[model samples]
Target: YANSTASGGRRAHVFNCHTDLYLEEAERHGWLIQIKSMIDLFDEGWTLRSIRKRLKKDPTCTIDSLGSPSDRDITPLRQGPPQDELPDFTLDEMHRQIVKFIVVDDQAINLIECPEFRRLIRLLRPELNDADICHRTKLRELILNAF
Candidate 1:
């Protein structure tokens, strides 16, 4: 009864997709697909056992089943391990390493000439044509010398 009103002892809430409020609500609580899945399950008349089995298989398929967020004060999620911390490499050092890594494979040079990849680049920024990327990378040595 997702898109239904409550006439027989049930409550009803309205959601307007046209507004940013709908987007915020969905974003605030992650698992955008779960909402649609639940609606579809309701429409298909899924049993509680079937729903439980599906939820067990994919844990992210349900909301916080034990309690709602409002039921308790929230705590910050855990951070990564100490080893996961950022390295202390300098910008220039990182740049040099990146360039070395890229140039190791000559195939990367051919990637610059790819039509589909060039289309993607142009789509990202229409002002930046295929020649822009190809010329920039190819003429890097000269450009760096000029700088």
Candidate 2:
């Protein structure tokens, strides 16, 4: 037995909605739809897998695979990568290139928008050696705004 019972007034670990499961459950009852990756669900909240699951009456959000509430009750997760772990931007005049990359590559822009990215720049500010401070500033500003 699945420890769950008929949906009407049944208290169980999970529900067996039996139809349009995802769409109907959230429509009728309180759904704790947890978002896992903002990037994954950027344009649309539902994916192909989610859509298929919805057809099977699994419309509500995935029960967070994350563990007990108290487990996360201790502290919020950190926002970005560690400060010290960024790659050394050591190639001669690489600042110009990285700034150019920031303007163009969406992925690079995502990385640069990170607070860690911001921090890395600040950390290495003294060592930047003035390849082109104006260009670097413009690039940083562009990245931050796009973020």
Candidate 3:
């Protein structure tokens, strides 16, 4: 029942998952495991392309070689400690964020419409009408670096 209300805007988060264990758990927990389109993944709050890119970039998390059409059960490939921390991630959510990143990188970083950035700039600079472009740019870079 989401509408165009401001509060209804997306809340993006960066998430990583035990892709293999995740799909398996889907069957266990009865979460939706139906094959979905890349766009569906993005709509689910993920960057489908980024998921692929992440798997390619890092081998340990590549759940499946092919996209949604592939029915093969993905093998678990955890390399370190078991992924149990609750930093804010689910298997589907992980896919969503990665799919979102494919289309939008800022949203992937959870920086879209950041309140802190807006508050900081208003509090520190207050006004930057082309006069403090260089200073503002450097300051912005510094803030990003702090993250």
Best candidate (score: TM-score): 1
Which lDDT tens digits does candidate 2 get at residues 1-147? 111212223212223333234324433332222223322331234432343343444434343321223222222221222346556565534544464444322233345445666566657666643333434355667545532
Per residue, candidate 3 scores C-alpha lDDT tens digits across 13-38 of: 11224454433433343333223332
lDDT over C-alpha atoms for residue 37 of model 3: 35
Error of 3 at 145 (Å): 38
TM-scores of the models, in the order given: 0.23, 0.21, 0.19
Candidate 3 clashing pairs, residues 3+ apart or interchain: 45-96, 45-97, 46-96, 46-97, 46-99, 46-100, 47-98, 47-99, 47-100, 48-99
Which residue pairs does candidate 1 place in steric collision? none
The C-alpha RMSD of each candidate to the native structure, in angstroms, is: 18.7, 17.2, 14.2
Candidate 1 segments exceeding 4 Å error:
1-101, 104-107, 135-147
Estimate the overall C-alpha local distance difference test score of candidate 2.
0.37
lDDT of 1: 0.37
lDDT of 3: 0.36
Question: Would you list the rank order by TM-score, best first?
Answer: 1, 2, 3
Expressed as tens digits, the lDDT of each residue in 2-63 for candidate 1 is: 22212111112212222223223333332122234334443454433344445566655452
- What does candidate 1 score in Cα RMSD to the true structure? 18.7
